[model samples]
Target chain A: MSIQDEFSFINQIKPTTVHHEKTLITGIGDDAAVYIPSPNQSQIICTDTLVEEIHFTSQTMSPFQIGYKALAVNISDIAAMGGNPLYYLVSIAIPSSWSEQDLIEIYAGMSELANSHRVDLIGGDTVSSKDSLMITVTVIGETEEGRQLLRSHAKSGDVVFVTGTIGDSSAGLELLLSKGRHGTFNSNEDFLIKRHQYPNPQVKIGRFLSKLKRVSLNDISDGLASESNELAEASQVTITLNANLIPLSKELVSCDSEGAIEKALFGGEDFELVGTMSMDEWESIQQDGRLQNLIKIGTVSSGKPEVLLQLENELITLEKKGYNHFKK
Target chain B: MSIQDEFSFINQIKPTTVHHEKTLITGIGDDAAVYIPSPNQSQIICTDTLVEEIHFTSQTMSPFQIGYKALAVNISDIAAMGGNPLYYLVSIAIPSSWSEQDLIEIYAGMSELANSHRVDLIGGDTVSSKDSLMITVTVIGETEEGRQLLRSHAKSGDVVFVTGTIGDSSAGLELLLSKGRHGTFNSNEDFLIKRHQYPNPQVKIGRFLSKLKRVSLNDISDGLASESNELAEASQVTITLNANLIPLSKELVSCDSEGAIEKALFGGEDFELVGTMSMDEWESIQQDGRLQNLIKIGTVSSGKPEVLLQLENELITLEKKGYNHFKK
Candidate 1:
């Protein structure tokens, strides 16, 4: 198909939510889509960009996988905020030699993930590049009145909880590298690699937690230890994490689990939920069936925000090192 | 700085407009942002990407220029839709070596443009790249209640009006290339090079035109000859241009006076508004002080969308040969 037809088809996929009551204005075909701001509910907008080398290696991953991961990562951020991800816009740049088939696969990846999650691809821009590929996704999500969680609410003597297993991405990366680069064949591989490729955002979990008024939440894109540090800094309280309660994968047995622990605590791109709960509500949290697997990684303290591990009856210090967008 | 401090700073830059009265729940620094769909207004969303070496060459432009141009281009899309721009989000991927100074300049450029247009930046993502830089901006704008303009609204006998001088960007690009190749410059030049460096979107003019009952507008991001064809195709009508009335630039005129005609008609990236107006209210438009400079460049007809140039009383065919994003 011609380029015009491709853009034409792309433009036709506007936001399908019918807003015939309020002052509904513009959508997809325009240069910029306009919408009336929600007066009753505040508008929640967030954007994230993924560089080819920094986020994913195209040599090993398929175009569709990359595309899906791009949207999924950003959606995870919204999930951390306790908001419902509704619409997303993507900006993609690729080499000129990339055929239409490649483009279709890339979009197919994004569409597959987005469709399952009910995310509408409202709009995006695409242009040619010289060398590597880059994709940026901007997600728009919303929360109910007073239900949106913020980092400032965690008080002294609160409890910290995290959802799902962590550090698998770091472990997955170690395996990929030890096997020596992108396309290293691993016929025995299953969940670890898939977690590395298509990490799921805990959307329902975030929404469910948002309704529990006393907790503050944040997603662990940059890892639990780092994100917990952020929560502590944001809430102005210290955290004492139980070294034993941190979850691990079965593959972690006989491995450098300490190093794996560090990776799970400090490694970036895990995409899990790290949250704060009040002391009173913390006891009730143990009784909740849906949150039974939600592990208490730490507790908010009265002192300066510090993460300490109780190892064999002695408290050991953990470093606050995590991902940095720009570091030499 | 702490993550909470970052959120504190980022929260200050959100769009506050009349459309802010409805369903969007919240924006930024939360687990997930929430957006309640409006069943009233038509929601339009689009995304675009710009890459190094393709959209702009780093050797010729600074990071600030790149950043400014990125948002400006997206804002131009809002202008194309005849919408009032509200806010925007940014996602950038740059190499590790890119300095803090470079980021400051880039944000300064973007902030200057955004602030001048009263568009707040809600939130964005930053990631490092291995090679070149990539910047993506998504702008959100809104039209007044029930005043949205559309390409589908153009009808037979509506007069076509185009704002500002066309092909100035093409002329500016030529000057830029000349400076690059020859290592010499036109020191007296003012508007020519600036046009290429900073494209101004006619958002206010677009919003104003959207108020008119029969206005069907789209910005001249592509060449005038090309956009007219789109408007015609959308309206299911033919178009004929008044060559004498087509706004021409002095820089274009300086480059072989006769050739100016061709450049003004086909060269793209002008960011000017091109729209159709019905004859019913043409008298009031003629008397408006702010709109007097708007030139009536063409007329709409009943046949298939075809461009014809009226030169020296001769009806000569003007083929649609303009910006093709894929081919270019």
Candidate 2:
């Protein structure tokens, strides 16, 4: 379909109302979307872009998976900041060769995710591109006063924790590369593929954590090592992580035919939350029934900003950090 | 530079803070940028994307101009909603062929615009694309509660008006295509080229119109006919535009060597504001010396939503509407 026709197609399928956010004054069909923030709430904003080959490929991901993961990444950023996901704007660049069915499925995937999160897909722009498909999603979320988390708030002696599993996405991608989409897998292998294809951003846990005082947070998209370095740099502290304490799913552990710890440290695209909090704060949150599995894997120290990995009886500084865009 | 290194480059140059607004609780260096909206204010959000060959080519635009125009387009969306431009998130897909200098210049151009508007560039994600450069800018603006304009609120019998000239960008593109970059031009030709390269979003005018009690507003990105059609369709009223009343820049008038009226009617990317207001509202606005040039080009009448162009002695329905993405 032509760009104009694609817009009309989008309008036909676009959701008109969000589940509960009545603050949307006007959505879609206009110059921009207008919305009101709830009383005494702060807005948290973030954006992420996914390029065809750079972020995903047709072999490993369907059109629906592409759309689903594109929004998932940005929502992860909001989740890391301890905000409730509310609205998202998607900008897509479509090559002429892409079928109408492909575009429809992409939107359908996004619609499904939006419905699950109660986040409105308010407005977007569509344009033609000469190359592969590219999608950019910007998420707007809200947090009550003084509840938002920041990367620059990690305090000395604070404990570091990560939600869900680390390195599963990287392992999943590895398996997909070797086996292709049609490869048969048992439940363990299927879990890895699912983890890579559909990352669940920890929004609920993030919101719950935001209400507690004195916590620093970030999402691990660029691997745990890179994110930890960023947190240390932002907070002007050093993060010392115990490799043994890092959480690994049973599927990932069993699939560690290669360097699993290395993947956990430096591989990218894991949409899990990593954060730091004082022992008291962490203990208080642990009391909540929902956070029983929150893993304490490290501690923040008063030192030059950096990330240090502690293995059995030895501490090593990782020279090769997470995936760098310019590095081959 | 790798993506992480590119981020550091962005940080070295990104604006530290906006001029007056301190609602930014945190900027950049975070999982997501957090900001508090001012009391009784509604957030107006919009996004626009520009692809290399689709939006502009190196033959017609410089990296600086591309960066400037990308943000300018999003600002126009905010202006259309009658909101004050505040913060923006930029997600760019840079091809490997682009030099670090080219990327730096792009950010410099965006920084120039952001500084002028006092809009903060809080955060963004950068990724590698194998093909062309892509930019997606999402703008966040604010206005007093209930003050923002909407495309759906135009009342029947309201007067339709537009700010500034129309069709200059389309005409400018035509000139650039025929003349090439080195072609000589007088003041008028230069003005057209400038118009095409850098559109000044009507932020001040939009804010003024937004403060008014009753107004329906939109920006003319697609031609006058297309935008009018959208307004008519949105407000559920017929919009009758008088061709003679449509305002044209002096440069556009003299430069229209062929079918200037057609360009004014159906050309795209004018970046001017087209809105509708009641007679009393128009009269009150016209009384202000600042709004003396706001021209009444059309009227909203009770009928099926459509746009009718009044010519010399007859009315012509615009069958060839605005620029459609997919249509040739």
- Residue-level error in angstroms, candidate 2, position A1: 4.7
- Stretches off by above 4 angstroms in model 2 are A1-4, A287-290, B1-4, B287-290
The TM-score of candidate 1's chain A against the true chain A comes to 0.87
Top lDDT model: 2
Q: What lDDT is obtained when candidate 2 is compared to the true structure? A: 0.85
**lDDT for each of the candidates?**
0.70, 0.85
- Please give the distance, in angstroms, between residue A183's alpha carbon in candidate 1 and its true position after superposition: 6.5
Candidate 1 stretches greater than 4 Å from native: A1-28, A34-39, A180-188, A254-258, A288-293, B1-46, B58-60, B181-188, B287-292, B311-320
Chain B fold agreement for model 1, TM-score:
0.85
Instruction: Please give the DockQ score of every candidate, comma-separated.
Output: 0.47, 0.74
In model 2, the clashing pairs are: A2-B326, A3-B325, A3-B326, A4-B325, A325-B3, A326-B2
Q: Where does model 1 sit among the CAPRI classes?
A: acceptable
* Local error of candidate 2 at residue A130 (angstroms): 0.6
Best by DockQ: 2
